[model samples]
Target: MSEISQAGGTLGAGDRNRSLTYIFGLMLLVGFGSPAAGLVDVPITFFLKNKLHLPAHEVANFRLVAAIPLYVGFLFGFARDRWDILGRKDRGMMMVFASVCAAAYAGFAFVPVSYPMLMAAVALSAVAWSFARAAEQGLASMAGQQLAVTGWMSVIWSMAASVPYLGAYLIGGALSQALEGRTAEQAARTLFLVAAGVMGAMALYSAWKPKFLYSHLKAEAHADRPLQDLARLFRHWPVYPALAVWFLWSFAPGSGTALQFHMQNTLHASDTQWGAWNAIFAAAFIPTYLVYGALCRRFTARTLLFWGTAVGIPQMVPLYFIHSVDQAMWAAAVIGLTGGVASAAYIDLLMRSAPKALQGTIMMTAGSLYWVAIRFGDVLGTRLYEQAGGFGACVIAITVVYALIVPVLLTVPRSLIATREGEVLPLEEPALEVGAQETLHA
Candidate 1:
């Protein structure tokens, strides 16, 4: 008995050491991917739209197309679960995917002429991003035993990712100003190339240190699960309202992506000015997350959700009165803070509602639905912006929708918080089972 106790202590210490190492490694991987993504998203959305001279509706349509591959990527988790693409090496898979993503970005940067080609590049980039994202998240879940820690780690990584956007805003703005005489296309392409180079370097780092920051897991030891199983898993009574809240929250801000262009053309803001304003918007979220983490300890997730939804009321309401670029920028910054808090609270709520084994799938599904809502909202909002004859009316319409979310948020009950500690309750299985049984019965 004494000998067994001693051996168990030794193994336990080893596991702790290994888990800590994995955590740090995951942080680095997140840092690389997050910033690269941020750099690309801002330029593609704001700069590309302006450069292409695409209408808001057309831009929204293309965005919808770009997002399709992301959903497809979610399905890849099943393959990832079954196969050892990089010989069961998570870091190797991450590098391979990141490389592909970099190449796709380069294609977008250098390939000239034809909107079809641009769309193709966008699709490829989305695929690569999906591959890395699925693998990275799966690894994060495995590394941290505590869901709260995993959530906190994600928050930290996101904060790091926000750094590149700040830099990109500053640099992209300066370049746009210096190249004032250049066509919008030329400036946009140049910025894309710069982002590509940054991503390419990170890809190489991931390849060279393939084992550097990865959790040590024997691929063969883990059981495989089907990705399609997620749809069934979401049918639980609790999941329904939780997901509704997620979709509504996502749809609200998705209109903001289109609003960036409105800031430029409608408000007549310079690229440099827009960039500065975006920087403010992006930076405001960091502190809010800190507050959220602190508040989570003292309050219920439901309370946080309620307050988050209520706070958002002010965000959309103020946008109706904005006249100048400065006002628009400040409003965006305020929205960012509100959005940051709301997002943190929502994610916390989601984690509580989902089981451990299904965390990635549930989160991805929720994300997919959120993006879908955004895509839907964007299409409608763009048309409304055009039909209503100005940004003010659009703001009012979205604000009304935001107000409606309060009651929707209230629909979530306190009983569904079982997954808060990452516990996978038997009751939650009914959601997934019902979906499966329905399909089977059908």
Candidate 2:
């Protein structure tokens, strides 16, 4: 046997680059498939606000219901980690669930329009999507760790998520307007049909099986002991810090539904203008995300974490100053820029801390926490917007939550402090696994 490269040596640098590129493309597809993205979200929100004539609090409640499935996302991740999906592992999971999601969307499209039905349909779709997300993130994290490109992988993931906002917001906004003359049932059919089409494309791509993904699938270990893996994941100290970061960072009380209502009620912003704001904000993240990709190659996670959180602490401050829609639009770009580096760095930390065998469970749990935080934040934000000092109160609350993350940085293990180009320091804890790395290196 020959020596395996330190980063699993199965693939050379060029090959790793190619694989990362492929994964980026897959993430893009998955991002569009996500219900939170503009493709599904804009239409749903418009339908609720314009057609059903629901208030902000009611809209938030519906959102909470639709996202209920995502809050238990770890169970889906556990399923992915433990099962082989007819012996095809991640690939099979992606294909099957993407199809299921497409079918769910189609079901929603044809069904009679009712709030309960819409919420139930979206929640069911969320369940299928949770599985697909588990596979997608699990594969990306595992491959990035094996290839020692976690930072670039983080960049790829964030960019894949953010890039869609640019065009999708505009398109979704326009699409919402286009459906104005149609009845609720007709609009439901039109919007969800478009969503079904995106998921259908996702299923097809999974079937195509890109080379890097196929190779990674071939190299993965088949036998999965969930209890043992779960124990090990809990015992791992590095994971806690990453989870804390994700939860705190995502728990912004000033954003999402609260912010939307503020723009509508206070600033008198129209739906199309709101979409333009999102588009501008998302576009601003691209350059900063790219910058962080370069910065991650040089700095350790600790260094980046400190500075990133510092930048994040003041991110919500811009919202405090926005008194008009035009000011809000400019502030959106500022807010996006402030959090871009921090968001990418957080994902880098997450990918770095994940145990090799239990990547899916860990990633999904983190994702679950994100949904939990966002939902609860929405609840709090709505109350604050109504009873408290309005949007300014929410902004202050968000800034304070962001500030709490700086202390969490201290909890990260010393091993993960290394830069992406370097090796993780040896830990005194139990080994994650010997098989996957050993096989890839072999």
Candidate 3:
């Protein structure tokens, strides 16, 4: 077993370096894939509503309909862990999946107004996204042996993905405004073509840098764990509460996507102004990640979680009184900062609570549930915002949810803290040796 020491903490330093190298390479590819996924979805929904003359409610139903395959895709994480292609590494499987995703997006971009084809494309893209996300998360865990390191990895990965979105929103807004005489379908098709190009670039990059990822693939040795056994892992004293906290935290502002229209309506901001505000919001996230990494090194994960939730309280509470575009923009920035911290802390805590081999399964399961909660909350919050006649009610609702979860988040046991000087101690030689073996296989 090899060890690397930094700041008085010993970890799989050699594997960490290897993982970082691979993660950076993989993130570059995955980053492009993410924005393509998001960008196409936006235009697809818009096309369905305005261009195809579908009802807004029917278009909203697409969200619920889409959740079916998305959840199924998440379940495929278990299969992805067990299945391999061409007797090659997990990265090879991921590359294959990425290629499939690119093809699916291209299909969506080129295919004309057939509902069945559109739905099929969405399903295929969802499945590919799920597989790629699961693989990426597992690889991140392999690279980041500790909670703090994982936080850093997630932040970097997020920043990579965010860049494309920032550009898309800004550029797409300008293009939409300049091309106002064009039909809505034309605008949507244009964006889809652009997104397809991004996905194509991602596929090319993945093919170009196969070696970096090949060395980091690992098989799931815990695949044989029974369903009950896995369920029981989360049934423990702190685990269930921790999971609940995760749900509430994610659900609180889960309506942010829905709230954009509300902001535009209330503040009377143009589409370009909204895009610029969102860009600032996304830009605000970078510093939060950096701050989170630093805080994770100095404080316990529980403490960070607590502080994150605390910071989030003010962020949501102020939404009720925001009457101007500038106020909304500032609020968005604060939400971005607090949301980033809370997310990084929550994931760090989740990773610390799971055993190494089970991390992927545990995380995938949690993420599925989290997304479900977010979906539910988004619906509820949007209804409330519509009926209540002001943003205040929505703010109150989210703030209350955040307040309730803070204590539960704080109750996460100190043992789950992965900081070396605090709770996590040096691994015994035998355990390190076994971990080394797993890394070799991975």
TM-scores for all predictions: 0.76, 0.93, 0.82
Tell me the tens digit of each residue's lDDT in model 1 across 85-175: 5553445556677777777767677666356765676677677766666556555543332323333443543455455556567665666
- Candidate 3 runs further than 4 Å off: 1-18, 35-37, 45-59, 114-118, 146-148, 157-161, 183-189, 203-220, 223-239, 418-442
- Model 2 residue runs over 4 Å out of place are 1-10, 212-224, 422-442
Candidates arranged by lDDT, highest first: 2, 3, 1
Local distance difference test, per candidate? 0.57, 0.79, 0.59
Candidate ordering by TM-score (highest first): 2, 3, 1
User: Model 2: how far is 319 from its true place, Å?
Assistant: 1.0
1 or 3, which is superior by lDDT? Answer: 3
Candidate 1 positional error at 174, Å: 4.1
Query: Model 3: per-residue lDDT, tens digit, 172-238?
Result: 5566566567865466567656655666665555444333333333333543555744554545455
Query: Which predicted model would earn the best lDDT?
Result: 2
lDDT of 2: 0.79
Off by over 4 Å in 1: 1-37, 45-51, 71-73, 77-83, 87-92, 107-109, 141-147, 150-154, 157-170, 177-193, 201-238, 411-442
